[model samples]
Target: MIKSLLIANRGEIACRIIRTARAMGVRTVAVYADADAKALHVRMADDAVHIGQSPAAESYLVGERIIAAAKQTGAEAIHPGYGFLSENAAFAQAVIDAGLVWVGPKPASINAMGLKDAAKALMAEAGVPVTPGYMGEDQSDERLKAEADAIGYPVLIKAVAGGGGKGMRKVDAEGDFLSSLESCRREARASFGNDVVLIEKFILSPRHIEVQVFGDSQGNVVHLFERDCSLQRRHQKVIEEAPAPGMNEATREAICAAAVKAAQAVNYEGAGTIEFIADASEGLRADRTWFMEMNTRLQVEHPVTEEITGVDLVEWQLRVASGEPIPLRQEELSIDGHAMEVRLYAEDPASGFLPSTGRLDRLAFGDATRIETGVEEGGQVSPFYDPMIAKVVCHGEDREAAIDALIDSLADTEVWPVRTNAGFLVRALDAEDFRKADLDTSFIERHGDDLIPSGEADDAIWSVAAQIAAGDDQDELVGFRLNAPARHAVWLSHRGEGRLIDLAEAEAIAFEDDGDLLSAVDTTATAYADGDRVVVFSDGVGYAFDTAVRGSGQGSAADGAIFAPMPGKVIAVDVAEGDSVAEGQRLLVLEAMKMEHAMTAPFAGTVKSLTVAAGQQVEVESLLVEIEPDEG
Candidate 1:
């Protein structure tokens, strides 16, 4: 085995690689950008090196810097963990040329599946079932439109080199084709530096199921079964599971077999995933499933597969890269049980799933089957990277038990101040449709409102907040009116809304310390006092309220000013000063965490001042534009 390995990535994957490498007695080197100097992965590694500045293009994505860091640290191999340079064919070749073992497939395999159009053509030639689409060399708009017209309405316009749902558009009719095509191409160029695209017939009810495949340097390949990644939002997977629910023996065998075939066709090596899109309008069947794409590296959801198959994929990658044969064959590998994984992101579901950044004041989780995370309490979730805080995984004898265990695990998860999808995930797992496995890519969208209800505090919550404000002086009777029979009030703010609760009239009260429940209500709600804010963990969600008197807290921004919802770079300013605009008109676009978010006008108005320009970085709540409300 390789003695020392360099992880060419950051965040959870880097930390994950470090765990397995150290366990195998391999020294590990972690490379970090300036922003990740204090990251958890850096502390876990045997040695650390600074690559470049905070921006990925200046650091993680720079192949030369990574190579230099590996050589300086005397790393015998480099593991491109999931992202950054993981799928870059040239980077793999460069590493091999430097006489360092690349813990991945040969460069040829990466190139074969790098672009969607080319990869689809290759898969077709290899006899892997592929979706019907246009993969021609025609770049003319008319030809592309004709192809889409032939493919029929509701076609998908996807970037040839895109991943993570970027540079993809679904056009339902000819009227929207041109505009959608332009938008898709623009995003494609921005994301992948390639404007080429491919059009596919969009499946009405698509389910994303990917098979985990591994190959050794000796030209042996095997699969670790399949995972259902159908639960998605914005085309990005939110949750994933192994031994796909509702999968029959026939469909499972066919999908797994196709995955193995695809891997062998390219003479694949190391760990890779073959993703398929199944038209579930008629349920999962071999013929309904078609090759969507292949991930040429370890995936973010690899843990679920590990849980079900009792395999350490990272260890397999190391051994294979060291010239070992495949550890298990198709007949030897079999699923043990059901497993589920949910990505706990630092994002607010109520705020359109916008990325949130802050110091993690409190972060905790249950005794999950496995938990992979890169941040701890007091850790900074910087705006410079993906907002995923942790990935929680659980396993059980079957799918229902796994779901039940996952829900309890989420309930045990506690996060404060920094918003999360914990509450949402629990609801999603507990949903009647979800429990029955009625899943698809549109699951989140179909039940978004129910999953992400308005963060309104109930009376019981207010009662708890009021007790915390009174402090630990239980000797003094809270809200005891000595003079007259009048109700005493306490002011609290929650979810940007303030409330004045009459403490003396509260129905029930509760206060606890160190898991002790002291209340009339028969419920356990853990709460603690943090400065002027009272933090509480109740019913699978975390809440914090500022103890303020009425009229003292900060109010919303001025009526006409458009505040930056989060810190990001201004990518586009659509209107000039004095331009008339209607309500909800897109005025500016901000790029943060590699995602574009549009800022729209709150009401019909004339632009009074446009203070920001393209390429300027703005902090959260910084005023970028101000409009004069139209005097109708």
Candidate 2:
């Protein structure tokens, strides 16, 4: 019996584990870094221990330090919730060596499935179908490229240690293989700290179907069915659901069987997910599927699995580690309802999906099916970790009802100050391709522009803001005093557009503009005017802005176009004094909140002047890189 458990990760997953463990009468310990001191996960746990500094390499990645914290806190088991050091074989072994129950798969199992090539080989040896690829001992780039050539174009050059699509790239043709290979290697090295890569035959228009497999120390392994995660961007799963839609009874059993076989081959114990990419173009076929990789810990999208199967995977992990048999057998398990989980990230979708960082001034997501989060209002979204804020999951009797609940939950969520992907998810759900069940991994890429869910406010909101600026209160009924001024100019800035509206105040301003009836619902209100703008407070955080257009051109120089790539402090300037440079040349590295972003040139040109010096904190669109027009 595990009495206490320490979660070795942060964010929503940590909060999720704590919720389940506490319900099972188990105490939870949360470990946080410098950046996550005031995080909600830390607040939700029974006990929290500060490990080290903010950077992951110095804090969360320190496996030995985490083990020490667990031992010191007397936590009987350590759960490496998903990311960070969850997949590290050494970390699991260290937890076992520290005389604490490791609430995860055996370290040998982690080592077995950690590498894509090794996992594929092991799956093949265990009679599980494997994808055709170069999973040999050869690390030669030439051999890999040759293998890709033989396999055919549209091959996938993926990192052996890749998950979350960080170290993966799709090569459409032979001409672009090497370049994509280089990019994949760079991203893989940066994300996973491992550069080993493998090439696999790319199944075009495929559906990412994965199975949820759970095992115990008693040699019992069973799957909780499948999840279809084909909706992705850059190979990172955005939406996932259990009992994968469109899968037939026979195909579902076969796929789950394969997943169980893959897990059993490693003698795996505890919660693990075996991901298999199935060719949904031909529907679900046993021969058309291939072994992808096995995640050796609880999944980020585990809520959907719990929703349909009615199982708490984290509790099962605790119970299994406590030397209990698997919760249920194949005969007892059944999918009850349709469920969906959407990753709500603190990022600006209109800005090329750039990570948005700021204090969450106001955060409120009303009671939905389930809102799992690890941050609250006043919590900062640091660049040190993943930018995901919460996972909003909703379940219903069927897929359509589930989708409707999910859409409604998003509309009801109000997160101000920091931008989010909520609007984009809403638009995605409303898309024709999605509504009609026409989805794939390429869904986001193909329909991304059409679904341009932006941060820019619409014209109607600006009109309302302008009305509020000119003493228009939506919540008050004001009688028109004939002695006062009959007309006033109302100005507002919205979506970067200057809006100027002349309003005549009255008991009811009876007018029509742009098919919108102008009616003043309230007038008795206090308005605080700041410069040319004012906010009419009403309802909650209600701000109606009216402002005059400050028409000014900054500069016609190349400075207008070239800007800093990310929010990083400038480390070193690579160009100065009108130096000539070619395309893709590095200009300066901006080190923001901490990560380094090298601002580069898009074309060959001579540097006119460097606007910023070394060690400057720059925003994303700030002027940084400057270059003259290239001469013939």
Candidate 3:
């Protein structure tokens, strides 16, 4: 095995790799940007190197800096953990040329599977069933539109080099094909620097099932079964599980065999995943499943596979890179039990899932089976990086037990100030449809009303907040009797709504001594107080109320002033000063955390001032535009 390893990534994945490396008695080196100087991954590594500024373009994506850091730290090998140069063929070649072991597939293998259009052709030749799509080299507008029309009414236009749900669009009708294609191409060019695209017939009921395949330098390949990743929102995976709920033995065998064959065709080495899209309108079947793409590196949901199979994928990657044959035969690996994983992100579900960035005043996940995280209680969620804070995983003897364990773990999650999707996750896991395994890519979209929290504090939440605001002083009450109680009113506000809660002094003290008021009312609710402010957490959503005075919260969009939700660069400006605009008209686009958000006019009004321009970077709450509302 290699003596020392250099991790060319940051956040939870880096920390995860470091833990496994240390157990093998190998020294580890970590690379960090300006925003991650004090990150948990940096502190956990044996040695650290400062790469560059906060922006990923200035640091993590710079291959030369990572290579230099490996050399400086005397690391014999480099592990590109998941993101940032993980699948870059040229970077893989460069590492090999520099006489360092690259803990991934060879350059040729990565190149073979990098582009979707080319990979589908390769998989088809390998006898793997591929989706029916148009992968022709023609890039004309008329050609793509013609192909979409030929395929069917609903078609998918995917960027040949796209991943992570970016650079993709679903065209529902012929009239919207060209506009959707333009938007998809623009996003693809901005993200992948390639405007080439492929067309596919969109499946009405699709389920994302991917098989984990491993290959050795000795030309042996074996699959570790399949994972169900159909639970998604905005094309990004929210929940994943192993041993799909409705999969039968024959269907599983066929898909797993096809995955192994695809890997063999590339002469693949190390760890990789063959992702297939299944038409689940009638249930999983061999004939209905088809190859979508191949991720030529470790995946974000690999832990679910690891839980079901008693194998350490990272260790296998290390042993394979060090010239070892396949450790286990196809028959040796068997699914032990069912496992599930949920991504706990630092985003607000109430406000359209906008990324939340600030100090983690309070963060706790009590007694979870396994938690992969990179931020501590006081750490910051910078606007420069991905907003995912942690991954909560659980395992059980069966699927229902695993789901129940996960729900219990999520209910115990406590995060203050920074919003999270904990409540939303619980609701998704406990829904009747989810319990019945009625899953698809559109699960979140179809049940959004039942999933997303209302963000309004109920009576139980207000009662808890009032008790916390009362403090521990009993002498402050006018009529403090041992038997009877003195009534007192506490004023509070949430999201600009004010409420006056009346509770007896004795009742408040009695509940406080019992220490189960919130739990009795709502099992998922908890309360915390900071100075004069109290925040009640229910179903993983934190509803903060000001205890000092009513109506002290921030103003809303009714004033016609639009502020930047977070620090980001203005990528597009669609309106000029004094321009008349209608409500909901797109005014500008802000790019942050590798995603684009459009700012729109809140009301029908005239542009009073345009304070920002394209290419300018602004901080949070910085006014970007002000409009003068029209008279009624």
Best by lDDT: 3
Residue 599 alpha-carbon offset, candidate 3, angstroms = 11
For model 1, which pairs clash? none
CA lDDT, candidate 2, residue 213? 94
- List residue ranges in candidate 1 displaced over 4 A: 477-491, 495-512, 515-524, 548-632
Error of 3 at 223 (Å): 0.8
What lDDT score is found at residue 479 in candidate 2? 26
Q: Model 2: runs farther than 4 Å from truth? A: 178-195, 466-485, 502-632
Off by over 4 Å in 3: 477-486, 505-523, 549-632
TM-score for each candidate, following the candidate numbering: 0.86, 0.81, 0.87
Instruction: Quote model 1's TM-score.
Output: 0.86
Candidate 1 vs candidate 2: the TM-score winner is 1
**Model 3, span 545-602: residue lDDT tens:** 7665332233333367776765578999999999999999999999866779899998
Question: Residue-wise lDDT of candidate 2 within 507-620, one digit each (tens)?
Answer: 233323322223223421222444555533221122324355322322245332466534456789988857988888888776654555677877888887677888776644
- What lDDT does the true structure give each of the candidates? 0.86, 0.76, 0.87
Q: After superposition, how far is residue 531 of candidate 3 from its true place, in Å?
A: 1.2
